[model samples]
Target chain A: MAILTGVSMQNRRPLTGWGRTNATVAEVIEVPNHEVAAAVKEAGPRGALVRGLGRSYGDAAQNAGGLVLRLLGSAHQAVLDPSLATVTVPAGVNLDELLRVLVPRGFFVPVTPGTRFVTIGGAIASDIHGKNHHVEGSFGNHVRALTLLLADGSTVVIGPQQQPELFWATIGGMGLTGVILDATVGLLPIETSRMSVDTTRIPDLDALFSAMSDGDDDFRYSVAWIDPQAKGRHLGRSVLGRGDHARLDQLGPKELLSPLAYGPKQLASVPPLVPPMGVINHATVAAFNEVWYRKAPLHREGELKGIAGFFHPLDMVSRWNRVYGSSGMVQYQFVVPFGEEEAMRTVIERLSVSGAASFLAVLKRFGAGNDSPLSFPAPGWTLALDVPGSARGLADLLHGLDRLVLDAGGRHYFAKDGRTTAAAIRQGYPRLEEWKAVRDSVDPEHVWQSDLSRRLGLTD
Target chain B: MDNALGEPQTILLLGGTSDIGLAIVREVLSPGARTVVLACRNVEKGELAAAGLRHGGLAVHVVHFNGSDTASHEQVIADVVAQHGDIDLAILAFAQLGDGAVTSKDVQAASEIAHVNFTGTVSATIAVANRMRGQGHGAIVMLSSVAGERVRAANPVYGGTKAGIDGFAQGLGDALAADGVHMMVVRPGFVHSAMTQGLKAAPFSTTPEQVAAVTAKGLRAGRRTVWAPGILRYVFSALRHVPGPVWRRLPLG
Candidate 1:
């Protein structure tokens, strides 16, 4: 596989998601812009899926016993029109790569996840949501139009107004409907690359809930980092950060000189090799959470910070996932309806009592969901956590949580979920049948497939 | 695909009537919806075993398979894969304990044991491994034994065949690793199953359930070899280096 041929097909290469769980092998091929249709035509029985940066936490990007295509798309060639406020970029262009090119041009991606290493194709496939999801909706909302490679080797231009059904289905279809070639995404205009921020460390779940529910509407971007192990009176203790783009007038004389400068620093990178047992176990996570909680400011406002510092702090240390070691990690993200705040509280309390060592647990509110049935976000309270993949009784704990989440009319995020069942997905997504109708209409023979799709019964 | 936690969706058990094989399947599929294909020589017994497993959420398909029939291995595997999409896990537990002392002087008896344990296992495993390799990812659990670690004088025929099969499985595992197929060789000291019903229990003897539990852990951890009762791994490690003359004098018999 290290040696490349003219066709660029690496046979039987093992792949895993960012979580590093459930590794599978596929024949990875670098399908060029023109050959995407050809790859679709020649995709064999197991079919084909387009992988981008391997950012999705689960098997959404992996096609077991099939072809995985990496399209050659670059952000350097992006077409940015400040007038219409849109950028037509290749699907393989990562958010960071695009940000480097676009931020200097006085524009920002409408939505970005915790990590900026995600591809445009992956962002749309997962319908990835961010802190701004409560105000701007998910990534699919800003996509004005997208070019797709269908099952029969035919390409189609789909948009919200044109072929909206197929368009939305492809949005969060987990790459089951078809492969996205490129997208014409609407961008958000910004005055500077710096963020004007506010930070608050709430003492308990009750106070944190009321604070978030009250203050979330005021900021364009808002999120809270909850310490999952904090229990009793201190249950769900968290630090909330809310922010928006810093205005030119907000910057000082020195900062105003190069207010649009976008040089995000990489302070350190985690070494590739780590201990077999991993460094992120219960004791270590508990200690880290305690120190992190004590370190956040009691209350602060309008603190000017770099965009990456505010959004992608974890991205500063590359290969950070290696901390989870060979056993890898399991990420569980589910959103319960607004009224079911009790259920969300119960999930937090249970994890606190169980002492399962969930790291970087965050809680947020999502705005109204779009037409995409498989889309993860909704008008609710969403909680996401990452735990040790090899933790004892972790599955049973998550399975129990699944019942509570589903009972509360909540749904799990496909991009972040690595261990949920199809039954749970069936309960979460009421409009799943409708989405399947559209997907099947396009992929009658079911050419598009993935391990996640099969596990969750989204496709064969 | 094995779920993110490495729980398989479909399982193919070559020895349908094996307690350890069924136990491993039970541990993995407990109360969860999954498919299990039981391929064994005895259809009636396999059905009975399948019935026991059906209490939990499982689709148990009892298929006919003759371990001694080397020529039929390929077709049997193909039939299973054709009926069931692809096997996520395959358990090769079909084995023969030759009657009496075959390694002493009876060449015919020795051949009978080798025919199934060594020869049949090699053919059948190759058939399944090939399919698993094509299927991209799979886990194979071969029920080798502690006796195979060093062929014992008390049960030389059974030990001899296991020794050969164990070596073959290890070699096959290395080749299959590049194809995303994992192989786990289970070496159990003794098991109080129907196969060893009347035998005197050894000090570190284990039940089928114990073996199955270890098998499940090994598969989850992607381990190449697993020892039942856990301590057998360390015990065998030390025993592997023991002087032959001193080892033979220890009252193992």
Candidate 2:
């Protein structure tokens, strides 16, 4: 392993992945071949950010002035069991690579979000959910066990049967409790690479809710791509898509040959000039939404679409975020309980009325969240928004939404947040006292901290 | 410099001639401290050093501080605080790293290194520690060494002095914990400065510039002890636990 000193500072210009909040730190440590144990020790007790494919779209993988373990280049030794449909993978393995290797062997990840560029470790840290979360739960649910390196510089294996407290604490711990070295996760059986999808464009918010509540169980994966510009009676209007993996009998011979690979070129894109406009004004957003809803393939059920086109359509565009211009963008995701859907509606309405141009709005049904104290998930309806960087008062606007989140008995996902106040955080995560006690007991010197820790009073 | 609340801080360096001492002062005295008193035995040399520091953009003053004059430590610390409000940092950099073999044969040389290095730092650290505890915020940087890990036959006197300072600084660090006072004990190996001139080059050779950078990082990280050529930190861990029989056979200073 090459030990590059901070004295031999690299002159590379500062580059931010997706989260464009904090200023870049000059003294960056890039341990090319450092062992997991050595890197953990070098972080002292302060902990480190284990960076993978850098697909977080936020600060989940950024650590300023602190060490960032680029685990992407770390060792890769995966063991797959075809019969049991489980795979033990190194934390740094990307989802795209994982599925490519396993899907041919008749298995697939139980749940995956809109992107296949994320690492298995990142998926667990964020506890990401897909269209089928209402039935299969979040990614943490599929995890059988995790090999964790605790804050005390000791290694421990955690699972439901052993070290249950630590296991639950780490399920959605967001890399705070420790660094996940590897995971043994269960995979679901898949018949073919294509999805038997059913697409519907709900005309208004009422029909959208009624359609989902009435027919959600008929499909394995369900998602609603909302148009945030819709206003008045048209508020919450969306193009809802749901699907189940196509069985071998359902697929034609041509689909079977190249099972999972995306079809010819169903391109995903947006106007390049739209991102720089910043505010995503109400007038402009309304026009965009009207066109999108009208463009949805009407009444298209049992449509044969490849896996990538069905589940991860956005993966087609390279550096798709450039559409948001130089300032980048923020992925604002929050959850409200079924009873609090009204509160969720109000927030959506407010965002639209305020001209928060959010082109990509994803709505998912989340089941029970993991027991991790700081984990941000609940049995609720979650709405995620992608707002362009040009929006003014972005921080203030998010703060306003944070209050609504706190009021709706919901907590802001630390992995997605960059500007939440400490006071609001305290209100959002009530079990923080318990986490603090554990953190203090293991680290009496108060050594482990991060940008999020300093911002949200996660540490003393 | 500035305290946590933005108030201007004050500082005094007892052995201003020491390179490591000046490095610590240079690292911690920016943005907050309104005054700095460089206390040395020779006023003329101290004035010259202070003038150079002033020319380089620092508020500095020269004063007399003879480490052998033990009774004067309390008064020196008090005078600096009186002239410049509260003393936020008081550095005990007065020490000598002379040849242990030569000092062993020369009683006068051995006594000077012991009294000036070990005793002076102990007195000054205690004096400033008390004042800072009462006022509720101050940091003390004591210059120790890797030689302090074990007393060696090659440089027994110098090693012993470092050992004593290391022990004192550790205790002071623990004692000042709840009182809002902090202590940073620095240990560097084979530093390339006037202190190590004419001596054979050793492994992990370092410069004052490197020492300054690490010390600044340590202060910001709220570290208690900073080791220059950071690898020595792991080296000392093994040396500190070695038995006397095994230690005596090792040719280490």
Candidate 3:
């Protein structure tokens, strides 16, 4: 816990999540770890919530009409213990900064989301998983212990061995349980910064599904880039990429010069000013999907790629969300059980028919989920897509998909959700009640709240 | 707590039974656990308007509101927020369309227009803005008449009222920009609603539904001002520079 400002102050700030929609205002306070307890105690009737890099793609980080605390955590203070294979990190520290320090030391985060801009707090709150979910599990699984500033203005350290119920509840609780101050996270010992990869172009959904199911577990990380526009025989056509951390011997002379060098590059950035209607549409997405698919090798093996190129290509463009236009953007990601292949295929078909125009649609397999009640993944296929908010009949289409997904025992990710009914959430997570009960026992006054909690009736 | 890609969770309609106001709400909202609060001087008319919008799952509440009584404004806004949490969107569609003959001679009509359309809205909207700013996220849509773009001579009193509120809404919108609350002014030209059903159809005359459609689009696009039928934006731009005498004499209808 750390927050030490001379005076207690608050700034009236309006903020929107990564998708840039549903802008909400709050009395934002920059709380040093020491002041976090005082800040939470002073939160008004609507209560308080903490925000990280504002990358949840929804209102998970917002607390309208209440207070929002930003913790003063930086990577400079992260203490890594190589002997114990653990790192004590402030919750506000993002992966980008942490990686800058760890990569040269031959280590990597146990789990990494699509974007490195996300903070350790958000990662646990959302319980984020990455390409290596099948091998490593979610962010919460690696979190050894964490400090939670409860609604009663009390700070407590919870972990798998201590107050396990509260620890699991807070993991994917969307910041409703309390504000996380810091965490002792386990790190993966890595050989080099580059990835030894495999790429294969599958002809259709059947081939893609089989390719992943047959051999994905053999690799440490795997994901597929989908072409939603390809219809009939080529429907769900994809380019599969699977890889493991490259060993020193696998690198060429040029790569050997600096095997552990890690500097994620920014090739270009989308400007702040973009058309209100956005530039992405059916035509643009179709062309992009075509070029992106063609650019990849038909069948490549052991291709050594940099960390940035493999894990976060989109990170190269700053404010890339602005390209979606002022109307805002909608990002939807969902996961169904492994046995529900038919349901997953139908969902993909519906999206294609709707012409979702998602240039970055991706599919990945998730391994067994942890005991966290609200965690999204549960040993299944997960698909993520970013669609323009202006998409025609989007609400109706998504609502329809919600029925289909829920009926097949699937659930939407709370982190990537901005528009889903409470009923849908209720149907998705059966353990929601158990998690809420644990949260209530700790803070019955319900001072910890967020817009997502209220929107989906998680805390209402 | 409202959905960005869908209809708002709650809406406050100032005009209560205003046709344009209800129409806009109808167009923007989809069926769900959504609430619409209607505020007007007459509770009966508000109930009647509420009946039309009472589809399955849509909750409509009628509250007493006197646009002329500026003192009661804050309470109206407070009551709605207290009962509904946060008013995601509000429509300032309540207006007294004074007699077109106010310029010739209609003292009572002029005062009514001034108090209700201009003064009442000024007070009520400011109250709403205050609460919304505290909430940190709300949208206010004021239904301004195209007549206000260049205060028309035919209906000077009504035109003058629209002009005042229109300017207020624009400035307030700019002020609220940093606060995250959005204020949009909708200028519809001669909309054929209950208020203007008997009146002669003017140039570029539209329907409440049409005005509502444009308003909904404006809110989505985050536009500060929107003209119904859209072409009126250019028409008013040219009319603003027209000579006073020549503008009055022109066969605008």
Strongest candidate by DockQ? 1
Q: Compare the candidates by TM-score and give the number of the best one.
A: 1
Q: Write the per-residue lDDT of candidate 1 for residues A1-460, one digit (tens) a residue.
A: 1213432334669999999988888888886678778666666778888899998898888988888888887888899989999999989899999999999889999999999999999999999999999899999999999999889878899999989999999898888888898999999999998999999999998998899889899999999999999989999899999999999999989889998999787889888779988888888988899999999999999999999999999999998989998999999899998889899999998989886777869999889999898999999999988888888888789889998999999989898877788778889999999999999999999888888887777885
Say what the RMSD of model 3 is: 2.7
* Interface CA RMSD of each prediction in angstroms: 1.5, 14.1, 1.9
Where does model 3 sit among the CAPRI classes? medium
Return the top candidate by lDDT: 1
lDDT of 3 by residue, A1-460 (tens): 3333422324766778899888887878787787888777777787888999999897888988788888887898999999988999999899999999999998999998888999999999999999999988999999999999887778899999999999999898888888898999999898889999999988889998899999999999999989978888878899999999999999999988988999887888888878778899899999998888888788999999988889988899988999988878889899999989999899889988887677757999999999999999899999999988888888888889888899999999999999887778888999989998998898798888888887777776
- The residue-by-residue lDDT of candidate 3 on B174-239, one tens digit each, is 988777789999999988888987788888999999999999888877788999989999988998
The B-chain TM-score of model 2 reads 0.90
Candidate 2 residue-wise lDDT at A418? 54
Evaluate candidate 1 and give its CAPRI docking class based on DockQ. medium
Per-residue lDDT tens digits for candidate 2, residues B1-253, read 2222112245688887777777766666543245778999978877777776663334799889888778998998888777765466677877777776789889999999899888887888888887775444457777788888766778889888999889989997997765556688888887888788888766777887788778766664457999998999998798889888997887542
- Any runs in candidate 2 off by more than 4 Å, and if so which? A1-8, A11-17, A26-34, A44-47, A73-76, A258-287, A441-448, B1-253
Relative to the true structure, how large is the alpha-carbon lDDT of every model?
Answer: 0.88, 0.71, 0.87
How many clashes (backbone N, Cα, C below 3 Å) per candidate? 0, 4, 8
